[model samples]
Target: MTPAPAGLTCRLCGRADLRSVLDLGAAPPCQRFMTADQLDEPEPGLPLHLRLCADCLLLQIPPLLSPADNFTDYAYYSSFSSSWVAHARRFVERAARELLPADAFVVEVAANDGYLLQHVAARGIRCLGIEPSENCSDAARRRGVPVHTAFLDKATAERVRAEHGPADLVIANNVWAHVPDVVGFTRALATLVAEHGRISIEVHHALSLVRDAQFDTIYHEHFQYWTVLAAERALAVAGLRLVDVELLPTHGGSIRLWAVPAASDVPVSGAVARVRQLERTAGLDTPAGYQGLAPAVGQIRDGLLRLLLDARAAGQRVVGYGAAGKGQTLLNYAGVRPDLLAWIADKNPYKHGRYAPGTRIPVVDVDRIEQERPDLILVLPWNLREEITGQLSGVGRWGGRLVFAQPRLTVIDPGAAAIEGAA
Candidate 1:
């Protein structure tokens, strides 16, 4: 992996006044799963640290790796998670009813596998997807969702606009934080939308990250973690006005922002002010709010290590669930290995035979859970705890328990209540 450039400046304001908030030392790229042959080869590690800009108040990490390094042949597929697809369906339905015109055209940036645009196309609306991964784009095409396999930039956005005209609704879900060029990408979003068109962006709220001690979400793939205050500043640079915002439960906690060209005379919704107040109340309006995160992160790491070691000492088998990017961060930071985690189960077949990047834990099919019936199943993607718990409810029949390692470690009997908390 490439080292972060010397004298790193804030990506948003181009200032060198970036304060270090939390550091996870160096870790391999979260999404870079290793093949069995490559396990013995040398692995590259990059610094995974969160910094706050004093000038712009943007919470970001240094751009250690480019987008191509992680996304070229992506391992993640949006359709794997049933709940996320249902979330996309609901967003498309709401956009068609309230935001779109009768003959509206839609464009989705970083649209993975056409999870959302499939819904738009099913409703007879004209839609297109701009994705960076060819494999993911192919999956979208199979679903009859037209996609252009290219990263969104100023030139690409201009070409798309010239060919298809301006889009009525441009949806960029959970991608605002993926790009290193924050201001430029925001400009591309503005360039893709019509003068009176609306742009929807979903990003993990920084408030949740700081408040809930969710340091696992801080990885190289996500360049920025945003709150309403920071988002408004970035949007203004692209001549887009933040008119509305909604708090979502996806990705631990997220906020969906609605924006329009500054030239448009649309009135800002009260939800924007309400969310700003919520951020202010949470102490996110200033850099002081970012304090105490590193210590909280340390406590979580210690707790997770204690749980895994105790389980091992007791002769209980503890396996993992969800071969997710965040899981990679948590495992590498806490120094978890195959001996402690055994094998991780994932529904995505692409990762079935591969090993996790740094720890080299095996990734297997979900059916292994039923075959082995491990005593403890650590649910890595805590955000999807409800859905994962329901799928593994049968583990209770075998006296298997579910474990959540973040925001505090909680052990729950599969079909019963939470039996333990914070080891």
Candidate 2:
């Protein structure tokens, strides 16, 4: 409708055949943090919305802000979670054994807090990190991982190669979907990659997300949701070919893939063939599959709102848990205010006292959820719903219920008993 808004364009093919699927209006940048004093001033925001391309299985949103501004001062610290640090360590340890060519250098783009690079450096592997966030770069440097504090563009890629020399292994995790200049960025990847060097990228899979109705993941920071097929098409244009692929349990369901120059004759792994089959079965390359997305996402949003209204009419107090980025997008899209969610709780100290983006739903510690004992506790981060419900089993004795905002709002009975909408 309305030409899908100029902001909507295919991130991979740059095709204009974009259709609006979900629109979360006027949300502040997901990772943009501010000092307490700066909060009083007007903070700018844009429509946190998304679209899907029928030609390619790429789901994307319009580019509102440049990664240069948002990423260079990025306040997100990857090592804040102990588990994330351990995950990074395991990745680097495996990468060293598999991808790292003897003494060749390794580089990680968006190497936040040096989580992965620390592991690389500890292994005595020559490594460097290209981190746009100044704060994160400083922390990475402190951890003995030399970091370049600038966004990785073609120019920056050349500079990095000249400065640290070309890397034998290039790792970009959870960032391949966030960039608007997908072409330039991938080309830069090709340029920075050493002769026959391998590049590994991990991104949230579009096919799985749509199939599961994970609409909450839509936000401004995530410019695209990529599938293996879409990535293959994009990479082919950049003179690169995927050598292997693996689906990881991380981030609900994500694709971790390895690729190298197209000239290499290495046989494509079985995993790649399996994904191709999966894509065909899902009809991702067809228009009918694209047509199903908007309706399914709408049904989820409508179902959740109806449940919340019913709970409110029944004189139940409802609060939300997890002020995550997805929570921000979901809350904003749902038009949920403090009236619907008394407050939201998060484990991260940095966000605990702040408000959810756009909705301004106050954030508090998990103890607040226990203390309030509301009849309904909305699990905003549906990806972590099972883990949270298991940990907070004690709060339901007060007739408190656990509700998930995704796949429709269904409540778990106060005693943590299985009830309608248990996923």
Candidate 3:
């Protein structure tokens, strides 16, 4: 595949001293789930070079594909994971108590399946979802949430504001990193938000990515990674102020940042200062903090490959669970093919007969696992291991075990049932 124009400078800070941190080989668009007929066709793969900006402490990958190529007909649905949906429900409740006003207008960018906006609408408040994926947006509209099927940028933000007025609360959860133009994305949110409005951003913390060795989360879809410091810098550059920040445990480790127009009189919350201080103490302010990640990531990849190869050597059938973006990255980077992993099982019908993007492994329904009773089930999305393990606990009856390949390759013994938080 041809390489797209790379961003020579950092997305947050216009610096050219971006240091190479990790190279996980070539990867395709993680969300590009292929159909059964397309499996034999050639797939595109772009260089995966994760770079770190010393100037702003931001971890970013250069732009490789246009947003339309990645998001227009996306296959990812946030409501698939019960835990994630529960997390969104809890977030909506908390926002109602803390940030959201009684009769406020709420807008969520990159809202998939109206997971969070459904809660806002249920509370009798005015809400809208700005999602680029037509399939996801259609699902949201069916759930009674008004949605705009357009990518959020400066122009789209202006049009949204003119049509529906400034939003009292604007949310861009998990989309900030997906945006190619980081500066323009921030400025667009600023345009949609009112002067007194709160702009909430949930991003996977770069510090956590290094600290926890979350290399699987690094894919072509996520263009940038942010620490509190880097995020604050980007927001400030777009005429926004970082008012508050909360470190959440979701998505390995994420930071929910609260911002407002720079000219607002809102006093910055103590949480912001505390998180900044915590990040600084964790060595996020220097280049040494970013060191050692490449090695740890390499170790995990090698370990996972070893387990799969050993299982195949022993004549054990190994099937995978969860056709997630992180799973695609991990499988592709580890050079796992259909022979080693067989097929992956997912509950989403849209992906049931489809093939994985880069690996081209067939995605079958979850019942197929019970039908085949593979000896070892590799749980690809390790973040939802507990939920998935519990759902497939019956596999243990047939002497089937579960495996995970994050931090390290762990094999859960057969008949070992998991509680909600066990994993």
**Total clashing residue pairs per candidate?**
0, 0, 0
132-166 in candidate 3: lDDT tens per residue? 99999999998899999999998999999999999
Stronger candidate by lDDT (1 vs 2):
1
Candidate 2's residue-wise lDDT over 323-361, tens digit each? 677777777767888877888877766676676666666
Q: Model 2: residues >4 Å from true position, as ranges?
A: 1-11, 24-26, 32-45, 54-57, 370-375, 386-401, 407-423
- In terms of lDDT, the poorest run of 10 residues in model 2 is 30-39
TM-score of 3: 0.95
Using Cα atoms with residue i matched to residue i, what is each candidate's TM-score against the true structure?
A: 0.98, 0.88, 0.95
Q: Which is superior by lDDT, 2 or 3?
A: 3
lDDT of 3: 0.87
Ranking by lDDT: 1, 3, 2
Per-model C-alpha lDDT, please?
Answer: 0.92, 0.78, 0.87
Candidate 2 structure, TM-score to reference: 0.88
Badly placed stretches (over 4 Å) of model 3 are 1-7, 417-423
lDDT of 1 by residue, 202-255 (tens): 989999999999999989999999999999999999999999999999999999
Question: Where is the poorest 10-residue window by lDDT in model 1?
Answer: 1-10
Best by lDDT, which number?
1
Model 1 compared with the native: what TM-score?
Answer: 0.98
